[model samples]
Target chain A: MTALLEVDDLTVGFERDGTRSAAVRGVSFEVAAGERVGIVGESGSGKSVTAQAVMRLLPLSAEVGGAVRFAGDDVLGYDAKRLAGWRGSDIAMVFQDPMSSLNPLLRIGTQLTEGLRRHRGLSKPAAREEAARLLRTVGIADAERRLRDYPHSFSGGMRQRVCIAIAAACTPKLIIADEPTTALDVTVQAQVLDLMDELTDRHGTATVLISHDLGVVSSFCDRILIMYAGRVVEAGPADDIIARPAHPYTRALLDSIPRLHGELPRRLPAIPGSPPFGTVPADRCSFADRCPRVQDVCRTNDPALEPTATGRPAACFFPLDSVPVEVR
Target chain B: MSRFLLRRLPQALIVLFGVVTLAFLMTHVVPGDPARLIAGPNASAATVASIHHELGLDRSLGYQYWTYLRQAVQGDLGTSYALQGTSVASAIGHALPVSAAVAVLGVLWEVLLGVPIGIIAAYRPRGLLDRATTFGSLIGLSAPPFWLGLLLLYALAYKSSVFPLSGYSNPYINYLILPSFTLGLGGAAWYARLTRTNMLEALRSPYVQTARAKGMPESVILLRHCLRNVLSPLLTMLGMDLGYFLGGVVVIESVFGLPGVGKLTFDAIGTLDIPMITGAVLFAALFIVVMNLLVDLAYAAIDPRVRR
Candidate 1:
C-alpha cells in the first residue's frame, strides 16, 4: 500500500554569503496511514529542516532537492492555491515554541478558526463552534470565554494546548510535531504528548514526531528514525532499535539516557564533541570522531545507510553487535 | 485607564512648568527689551518707564516668574507688546486652526503615501520599489523644508499654476495642498523607513510563519499577522509626528503666506512681542505632552501585552 507521506532522498541546503551549505543531506522516510513515526536527533541533525521541507515552509533562499509525496500528490510542485489547501488541511504542524508560534495580536479563536474557515469552507459561526470543540478536545476548559483572550492572557501550558488545538483543528491526514514538548515543564510534557496521541488516535491520523530525547520517541512511536549530523544513522522498529541499537551512535545515545531503576551515576554521561556545524563532511563516517567503537576504516570510508544482517537499515560500516559489512 | 492617567498627571504638570519656565527665562534674558520695543523710539524716558510698569517688567524677577506661571495656568497670557490690545491667547486662537489644518492634511498625505510604500517595499525586499523608496527617503530626510517649500511653490504654484501662488483660499484645502505636500514629503520619508524596517522584522517573526502554515493566503499573512504587529510602532510614530507637526508648520506656513501660529510667532518675535512668544512656546509644548500621553493610552488599548 502507498504510504500517506513518502519523503524520498530529501535534501535541503541554505544559501549564505553566496555559497550553499547543506543542512539536511539526502534523507528518506515514510509514514503510513495511522502510523506514528518518531525522528530522534540532536541539534543540527536536519530533522526540523526535513519537516519544514515537507510542508514547503522553508525560506525562498533555501535549496531543497527531494520528492515529498503527500497522499499521491506532489507537495513540492504544488502551486500557490493547491499548496495552501494541502498545508493545514492535509498535513499540519505543531511548532517547538508555543509562545512564538501563535500570533500575539490575534484572538485565540481567530487563530484556531482560520484553517477551518479557509480549508473546510465552513461558515463563521460553524467554524467558531468547531474551534471551541477543538479547544475542549485539547483539555482546555471554558473554551468560549478563552476564545476572546489574546495569547498573552494564556499561560505557557495553556498556550501549548492552544497550539495543539490549532494543529488538530482541520483534522489533517498527517501531523508533524517538532519537539512539541521540549519547551514545556516535565509534568506538562507528558500531558501534551498524551493529548497529541489521543487526537491522532481519534482522527486516525499519521504522525511524525521529532525530538532529541530517545526515551520520548521510544515510548511513543511505532517506528523510530535515529538521525545524527543530518543523516538517519539507524532506523527500525522502536522496540528492536531501543533494545539493541545497530549504529554505535545510537548505542551511545541509549547509554546516555539515565535509568530510573539503575545505580545512580554521579554525573550524567555526555558525548565528548559537538555535532558538526552544518552537514557532516562527505569523506568519512559522520559520527566516527565521536563514536566510542571507532575503527581506522571508519575515518577513510563514507557509510551509506543499508539494511543489515539483522534486517534493519544502519549507516555505519561496522554496526553494533553484528559483523562488519563490506563497503564498495 | 484611570490609573494610567493618575500616574501621568504629575508628569504632565512638571513638563508644563518646565516649558513655562524656559519660555519665561528666554524672553526675560534675551537682548531685546519688550518695553523699549513697545514705546516709540522718539518717546521720553517717562513714557518707557510707565510702559515697563504697566507690563510688569518693573517687578522683581521671582515675582514676575510667579505671575507668569499663575496667569498662564488661569488662561491669561498677557496682552501683546507689538499689537497693543491684542491678547496673546486670542491672537494664537485665531492662527492655530490654519496651522492645524495644514498639519492634519499633511499627515494624511504622509500616512497615505508613506505607509503603503513601506509595506510594498518590505513585502519584496531588494525589489526595485524598495531601492527607490530607500533613495527617496534619503532625499526627503536631507532636503531642507524651506528649500523644498520654495521649490514646490516655484514649480507647482508659480511656474505651472497647478495651485494658487502664495495665498489662502476659500475652501482652504486647495491652497493648502502645495504646503502640505512640502511638509508631508519629509515626514513621509521617515514613516516609510520606520514602517519598512518594522514590517520587515514583523514579517520574519515566527507568527508570520505560523500564519503561513495555517493555509491562509500571503495577503492575509502580510496584513493580519505582519501588519498588525507593525501597527503599534507606526501609530507611535504617527502620534509623535502629528504632535510635532501640529505644534507648528512654521516654514511651510510662511512660504504659503498662510497666517498660522508659526507665522504669528515669527511676526511677534520680529516685533518683540514677549507675551505672544511665551504663549506660543507654552502651547506647542503642551500639545506635545498631551499627544504623547494620548499615544501611551492608545498603545495599551491596541497591544494587550503592554498592559501586562
Candidate 2:
C-alpha cells in the first residue's frame, strides 16, 4: 500500500554570507497509513526543517528541493490557495511551542471550529459541538464550558491540549505532533503524551512524532529515524535500534541518555563535536571529527546509507554487525 | 470607561491650572502697563491707578490667581481690557470656531492622506513611492510653517490667482478651500513619515507572520492585523502631531490674515491683553488634554492587552 506521506531526497538550504548552504540534505522517509514514525534529532539536525517543508511553512527565502507526496498528491507545486485547503484539514500540525502557536486574541472554541467551518462546511452549532467533543477526547475536562475562554486563561498543559484539540478537529489523515510535550513539566509531559497516543489511536490517524527523547520515541513510535548533521544516519524498527544501534552517532546518543535504575560511576558518554553549521562539507563523513573510530578515509570520503547484516540501514563504513559477535 | 475618565480628569485639571498660571503671570510681567495700553499712551498716573483698581489688577498675585481660577471654572473669563465691556470669554468664543474649523479640516487631510501613503511606503520599501515619500517628508519637516504659508500665498494666491491671498471669509462659502489646504499640507507630510516608520516596524513583528501563515487574505491582514497593531504608536504620534498642528497653525493663520485664535492671541499680546491671553492658553491646554484622553481610551479598546 502507498504510504500516507513520502518525502524523497529532501534538501532545505539557507543563503548565508552570500553562499547557499543546506540545512537538511538528502533525507528520505515515509509513514504508511496507521503507522507511527518518530524523527529523533537534536537542534540543527534538520528534523524540524523537514517537517516544516512538508507543510510549506518555511520563510520565503529558504530554498527547498524534494518530492513530498501526501496521499498521492505532490505538495511542492501547490499554490497558496490550494495549500491553505490542505493545512489544518487534510494534514493538521501541532507545533512545538504550544504557548506561542495559538493566537492569544482568539477564543479556544473559535480557533478549533474555524478550520472545521471553513473546510468541513459544518454549521456554527455543529462545529461548536464537534470542538467540545474534540476537547474532551484530548482529556480536557469541562471542555464545553472552557470553549469560550482564551488561551491565556489556560495553563501550559491545558494550552497544549487545546492545540491538540484544534489539530484533530478535521480528523486529518496525518497529525504531525512536533515535540508536543517538550515544554511541559515531566509529569504533565507523560500525561500529554499518553493522551495524544490514546486520542490519535481512537481517531485512526497516522502520526509523525518528532522528538529528541529516545525514551519517548521508544515508548510511542513504531519505527524511528535517527537524524544527524542534516541527514538520517540510521533508521529501523524502534525496538531494534534501541537494542542494537547500527550508526555510531545513534549509539553515542543512546549512551548519552541518562537512566533511572542503572548507577554508572562515570559520567554519561559525550559526542565530541557538534553538527556542522549551515551545511555539511562537500566530501567528508559528517561525524568523522567526533567519531572515536574515525580513519583517514573518513575525512576524505563521505558515507551513504548502506544496509547492515541486521535488518536496518547505517551510514558508516564499519557497520555495527561487523564489530564482532560479543564486543557490544 | 469610568476608570479611564477618572485618571484623565485629574490630568486635565493639572494642565489647565499650569497653563492659566503661566500665561497670567507672563503677561503681567511684560514691560508694557495694561492700563496705559488700554487707555492711551498719555494717561495720567491717577487714571492708571484707578484703571488697575477697577480691573482688579492692583490685587495681590495670589488673590488674582484665585479669582481667575474660580471665574474660569464658572465659564466667566472677565471682560477684555483692550475692548471695554466685551468679555474675554466672548472674544475666545468668536475666535475658537474659526481656529477649530481650520484645525479639524487640516487633521482630516493629514489622516486621510498620510496613513495610506505610509502603508504604501511600508508595503514597498526601496521602491519609487518609498523614496518619494522619504524625500517629500524631509522637505516638509525642514520648511518653516510660516515660510511655507507665505510661499503658498505668493504662488497660488497671487501669482496664479488660484486662491485668496488674505482675509478670512465667514461661513467660508466659496473661498475657504485654499487656507485649509495650506494648513493641512505640511501636517500630512509629517504624519505620513511617522506612519511609514511605525508600520514598517509593525510589519516585522512575529504576529504578522503568524497571520500570513493562517492564510488570511492580504487585505484583511493588512487592515485588521497589521494596521491595528501599528495604530498604537501612531495614535501617540497623532496626539502630539495635533499639538504641533495647533502650534503651526498659529503662523499659518497669521500669514494668511485669518481671524483665528492665532490672530486674536497676536492682537492680545500687542495690546497686553492679559485676560484674553490667559483664556487662549487655557483653551489650548484643555483641547490637548481632551484629544490625548480620547487617544488613551482608543488604545485601551483596540488592544485589551494594553488595559491589563
Candidate 3:
C-alpha cells in the first residue's frame, strides 16, 4: 500500500549570530494510511521540530529542506491560502497544553464549528449540531449544554477532549498530536489517550503521536521512531522495538522505566550525559559524545538508518539481535 | 454581575464623598479671600463687611461647608462670585457640553489612531513601523502638552494655515478640527504606546500561537482572540487618562480659546470665585469616579474570570 504521509531527508535549522544550528538533521519516515506512528525523544531531541516542519509552522528564519509529500502533494511551497486550507482540513494538530490550545474568550461551540464551517461549508445551525455531536464523540457528557461554555470553565482533561474534537471536526487525513498528553495527570493522560485512540481508529485517520513516554508509545502507536539529539536513532514495529530494542539509547530508555511489580531494591538506570542543542550539521554522528559504546570512527562518520535482520532499521553500526528476557 | 457591582458601588460612593469634601475645604484654605477679590480694593471697610455678610463669607467655615454641601446636593451650587447674576451650576452647564464634546472627539481619535498603530507596530517588531511608532511615542511622552499645543498651533494653525488656532465650533461645520486634534494627538501617542505594549504582551501569549495552530487566520487571531485579552489593561489606562483629560484641558482650551469647564475653572481660581471653583472640582471628581466605575464594568466584561 502507498504511504499516506512520506517525509524524505527532512532538515530544519535555526540561525543565531550568523551561525547555523541544526535542530533537526536529515531524517526520513512514513506513516501508512490508518496507522499510528510515535516519535519518542527528550526535550531537545527535535521531535517537535520535525512535527512542526510537517505543518510548515516553523519561524521564517529557520530554514527547512525536505520532501514532505502528503496525499500526493508537495506541501513545502504551499502559499498562505493553500496552507490555511491544509490546516484543520488535511492535517490538524493537538498541542501540548489544552489550556492554551483553545481561545479563552470563545465558546466551545464557536471554536469547534469554525473549522467545520470554514472547510466544510456547513451552515451555522448545521455546524453547531455537528459540533455538539463531535464533542459527545470525544467523551464530553452533556455536550450540547457545555457548548456555550468558554475554555477557562473546562477542566484540563475536558479541554483536551475539546481540542481533540476540534482537530477531528473535519476528519483530516492526518493528525499530528505533539505531546498531546504531556501536561495531563497520569489518570487523565490515560483517559485522553484512550479517547484519541478510539476516535482516530473510528475515523481511520493516520496519526503522528510525539511523546517521551515509552509505555504510551508502545501501547498506542503501531510504529515508533526513537530519536536522540536531533536524529532518529531507531525505528520499527512498536512491539518488536519495545520487546527487542536494537539501539543502545532505546535499550537505556526502556531500562529507565519503572515496572509496577518491580522488587523494592530495584534501581532505575539513567543515561549519564545531557543531549546537545547548538551544533552545525556535519559528517559527525550527533550522539557520539553521549553514547557509551563510542569509537573513534563513530565520532567522525555520520550513521544513516540501515535495515537490520530484526525487522527494523537502526542508525548504529552494530544492531542487537536479541535482549535478555527479564529486561525485555 | 450583581456581586461585583454590589462591592464596587459602595467604594465609588465613598470616594465621591471624600472628593467633594476635600475640594470644598481645600479651596477655602488655599490663601484666597473671595470677598476681597470680589469687592475690589477701592471699596470702604463697611462696604467690604456688607459684601462679606451678603455673600455669607462672614459665616463660620463649618456653617459655610454645611450650607454649600446642602445646596450642592439640592443642585443649587450657589452663584458664581466672579460672574455676577449667574449661578455656578448654570455657568458649568454652559461649559460642560463643549468640554464633553472635545473629550469625546479626542478619545475617539485616540482609539482610532492608537489601537491600529499599536497593532501594526506589535505585529512587525523591530521593523520600520515599530521603530517609527516608538520614536513618535517618545516625542509625545516627553514634549509638554502646553508647549506642543503652541507648536502645533504655530505650525498647523498659523504657519501652514490649514486649521484654526483656537475655539469651539459647530461640529458639523468641521471648525473644531485643529484644537480637537491638538488636544487629541498627544494623548493618542500615549494610548498607542500603551496599546502596543499590551498588544505585544498578548501576542506573545501561547493562546495566540494556539489560535494560529487551529487554522484561524492571523487577522482573526490578532483582532478577535488577542486584542480582547490586551484591552483589559489598555481600558484601565484609557479611564485614568480620561479623568486627567477633564482636569488638564485648561491650557489646551485656553490656548485654543475654547470655552470649556477647564478655562472657566482656571479664571475662577484667578479671581477667587469660590463657588465656581468648588463646583468645577466636584464636577471633575464625579467625572473621574463615574469613568472608573465604567472601566470596572468593562474589565468584568472583557475577562470572564474577573466577573463574580
Candidate 4:
C-alpha cells in the first residue's frame, strides 16, 4: 500500500539562549491513502511538534532535521510560494482551541470563502454558495445567516464545528486534527468525532489524529502510535494494542482509562512519574524511571523499536507478555 | 448610538465647565490686569479704574464666571481685548479652519506614512528598515514641534527654496505643508510605534496561523487577517489626533505664522484678554470630548463584540 504522507526520522528542537532542547527526537510514522492513524501521548511528548514539522509550520529559528514527504514530494524542501499552494489544498489542520483559531474581526463567510476562492478558484457568489453547503454538511443549521455572524457569537462547540467545516472545505487528501474535540463537552465531542469520521469516509481522506486520551484515539483511529518522552514507545493496530499492550508505558496508559463495568477503585490509576521533558541521554531508556518493569538493562541501554512477540513493534527492555483481563 | 451620544454630552459639558472656570480664575489671580493693559502704563489711576469698572472686570470672580458660562452656552463670548472690540466668537471662527487644515493634513500624513512604515517594520523586526524607523521616531518624539518647524522651514524653504517660506495664500496647501509636516512628524512616530506593537501581537495570533494553513499567500494573510486586527487601536489614536488637531497647536502656528486659534489664545494671554482665552480653551476641550465620542462610536462599528 502506498502512503499519502511519510515522516521519517523527524527531529524538532528549539534554542533558548545558547542551549538547544529537542522537542521531538527521531520520530517516524506514515499514513497510507485514506488511513486513520492516531498518535497518543501526554503533554510535551512531542505529538504536536511532530505534526508541525510535517506541515513545515515550525518557526524559522527552530532547529529541524528530517524528511517530510507528502505524496512522494519533499514537503520540508518546498519554497515559500509552493508551500503556500501545497497547504490547505493537499493537506489541512484542525487545531486544539477553536475559540482562538478563528479570527475575531472576520465574519464566518469571509473566513470560509477565503479558502474556497483561493484553492477552488470559485468566484464570490459561488464561494458563498459552497461555504453555506459546507456549513450545512457539518450539521450547522441556518447556514446563510450563521455565515454572516462573527465567531464570538457562536458557542465553543459550534465554533469547533465551524473549524471542522473549514478543514473539510476543500476536501484535502489528509487532515491532521490535533485534539479536535479536547475542549468540548463529552456529548459534543462524540458528535464532532462522528462528523469528522463521516466526512473523511465520504471523501476517502487520510487522517492523522493527535490526542492524549487513549479512549478517544482507540475508538476513532485504526492504528495507534503511543508516544512517551518525545519518542514512539509502541505502535500497532488499535484493537491489538488495547487487547495486549507490549510496552510498559502503553500498559500504564491503558490502565489509566476509566471503565463503566468494573468495580471502581476509590482513585483512578495513574502513571507513577511524568515523561522526561527533552533530550534524554541516548544510553538509557527514556521511560526507565517511570516503568514498573524497569531493570538494570533498562537503566543502562535505550531500547530501539523492534517487533516483539505481539507481532507489533515496541521499544522496551522488558515487553509485557501477560494480558490484563480487568483492563478490557 | 443616539443614546450613547446623549449620555456623553453631559460629561463633556462638565469638563468644559471645569476648564473654563480654571482659566478664568488663573487670568484673574495673575498680576496683569486687562483694564490696566488696555489703558496703558502711562494712563492715570482714575482712567484705569474707570476702564476696569466699564469692562466689568471689577465684578466679583464668581459673578463673572456665572455670566460667562451663561453667555457661552448661547454662543456669546464678549469682545476681544487685544483686537479692540472684535467679538471673541468671530475672531475664534476665523482662526479655526487654519488649525483644521493642519490637523487633517497631519493625520493624513500620519496614516499614509506611519501606518505602512509601522506595518513593514513589524514584518521583519530588528531588520534594517525597522532599525532606521526606531532611530527616526526617537528624533520625532524628542524634537520640539517649534524646533522641527524651524528646521524644516530653514532646510526646505530658506536653503533649497523647495517650499514657499510661509503664510496661507492662493496655493493654500503649499502653505499648510511645512506646518502639517511639523505637526505630523511627532504623531507619525507615535502611530508607528503603536502600530508596530499591535501588529506584532496580531501576527502571533492563531488566526494568522489558520490563514497560512488555508493556503493563502503571505500578503493576503498580513493585509486581510492581521491588518484588520491592527486597525481597531489605530483608529482610536487617529480619532484623538484629529480632536486635538482641530484645536490648533500653539507652537506650530506661531512658528509657521498661521492665524490659528492657537495664535488667538496666545495674543489673548499677551493682552490679558480673559474672555478670548477662556473661549479658546473651552473650544479646544469641547473638540477633544466630541472626538472621543466619535472614537467610541467607531469602536462599536468595527468590533461586533462591542455592539451589544
Off by over 4 Å in 1: A322-328, B40-42
The CA lDDT at A112 in model 4 is 94
Q: Which 10 successive residues of model 2 chain B have the least lDDT summed?
A: B206-215
| Cα lDDT of model 4 by residue, A41-129, tens digit | 99999999898888888878898898999999999999989998988999999999899999998999999999989899999999999
- Name the candidate, 3 or 4, with the larger lDDT value: 4
Better TM-score candidate (2, 4): 4
Interface RMSD of 4: 0.8
lDDT of 1 by residue, B43-95 (tens): 88999999899988999989999988788778999888888788999999988
Please write out the lDDT profile of model 1 over residues A1-328, one tens digit for every residue. 7899999999999989877788888899999999999999899999999999998999888999989998888889999888888888988899999999899989999999989999899999999999999889888899998898999888778898998888888889999999999999998899889998899999998999999999998888999999888888899989888877788888778778887765667887888897887546799988889988888988988899998766899998887775432211
Best lDDT among the predictions, by candidate number: 4
| TM-score, chain B, predicted structure 4 | 0.97
Clashing pairs in 1: none
Q: Candidate 4, which CAPRI tier? A: medium
Off by over 4 Å in 2: A16-21, A123-129, A139-148, A265-273, A319-328, B1-8, B29-36, B39-63, B120-214, B239-248, B255-259
- Number of the candidate with higher TM-score, 1 or 2: 1
Deviation (Å) of B90 in candidate 4: 1.4
Q: Per lDDT, what order, best first?
A: 4, 1, 3, 2
User: Sort by TM-score, best first: what order?
Assistant: 4, 1, 3, 2
Task: Find the candidate with the highest DockQ and give its number.
Answer: 1
Q: What share of the true interface contacts does each candidate keep?
A: 0.72, 0.05, 0.48, 0.72
Cα error of candidate 1 at position B78, Å: 1.2
Q: Which whole-number lDDT from 0 to 100 does residue A303 have in model 1? A: 93
Tell me the tens digit of each residue's lDDT in model 3 across B1-308: 78877888899879877987898888888996777777788878888899899999899999999998888889899999879999989999998877777777777777888889988888887899999999997887787767887887888878988876566666422545665676777777887887788887887676665555567787777788778877888798788767766653788778878888989999998998888888998888888888898899888788777764
